[model samples]
Target: MKAKTIFIVIVTVLLTIFLMDNKDAVDFNFIFVDDVPVSKLAVIGICILIGFVLGFLVGRPRKTYSSYNDEIEDNYPTEQPKSTLSDEDRDYIS
Candidate 1:
């Protein structure tokens, strides 16, 4: 798991640097509102709204079966095993 995390971090950093260095080569021109005269404030507002929605969705905690079961089990006390008795205690008396 540690190695996977490190690998992901290294890959993410390398990709970020590579993309930043070659950003000019990438064609990401938008034509919807670029050609027309539009309010810069409106574009900023739309971007903020989109970001808020995305953050809310990603930040929400995901539920799992184990989490539900853990909550239910917490309410009950678990049983423990009994101690072993002496060998004489195992002998049956007539």
Candidate 2:
């Protein structure tokens, strides 16, 4: 089979084993709530789902300008062309 299919199969088997092992109920306590009984597998699945969602949102690429001229201008002054000839030098050249 393909590598991707093999990987998916392996992950599915591992996840199934993990869920089976963590099927016991556990008590969770939050600051604003009393103790809640929930399956360990359910809690692990929720956390993994939340982590994947957050990762996808945070890891998305942001829009950026590709061209150099498309960039934002700063307050820095650009270099001006300097004249090599003065008034006396111009007379000599003429």
- Give the alpha carbon lDDT tens digit for every residue of 7-27 in model 1: 979976775575445433222
lDDT for residue 73 in candidate 1, whole number 0-100: 77
Query: Per-residue lDDT for 34 in model 2?
Result: 75
TM-score for all models, in order of appearance: 0.39, 0.56
Give candidate 1's TM-score.
0.39
Residues 1-94 of candidate 2 have per-residue lDDT tens digits of: 9999999899978988988899899899867877899899999888877987999999999877564554423433456567788999999988
Candidate 2 regions off by >4 Å? Answer: 1-9, 66-94
